[model samples]
Target: MAHPLDYLYFSAVMYTSLGIGDIVPTGHMRFIAGVEALNGLLLIAWSASFLFAMMNRLWDWEPCVEPKDEE
Candidate 1:
């Protein structure tokens, strides 16, 4: 049937954090979109967190090194 297609279509919309206002769902289906939106937000946050951690691990990123005064 078209159920999976519809789910995926809406999910794709959700993935991009886009609500085109075309596929409006009724009743319980409405909750699905909300969940998708939340998922998208969490995923975006998670990606940002992961990238920050990766960068910290990869770079020396040192600041305020002690100055060496040669006598």
Candidate 2:
């Protein structure tokens, strides 16, 4: 409250959905905190899926085999 760093710390906590007991938000801030937590969760899920899709597209998972010699 007294220093700018406090707001930064609060934002970090809210964005991560930590919801620690200390430094609780009041009034309008509570709404912002809830929105931030939800946004963080959605972004995390989206990022994971996007990364997985990208990796799948880039990697080949099939196995390779040598041909048999003719008799």
lDDT of predicted model 1: 0.84
Q: How accurate locally, in lDDT, is each candidate?
A: 0.84, 0.85
Give the per-residue lDDT of model 2 (tens digit) for 1-71. 25888888888888888888578888997898999989988888899999999999999866568666699
Q: Give candidate 2's TM-score.
A: 0.75
- Alpha carbon deviation, residue 19, candidate 1 (Å): 0.9
- Candidate 2 positional error at 50, Å: 0.6
Best by TM-score: 2
Clashing pairs in 2: none
lDDT of 1 by residue, 1-71 (tens): 46788878978887677988777878997787789888998999999999999999999975678876799
The C-alpha TM-scores of every prediction are 0.66, 0.75
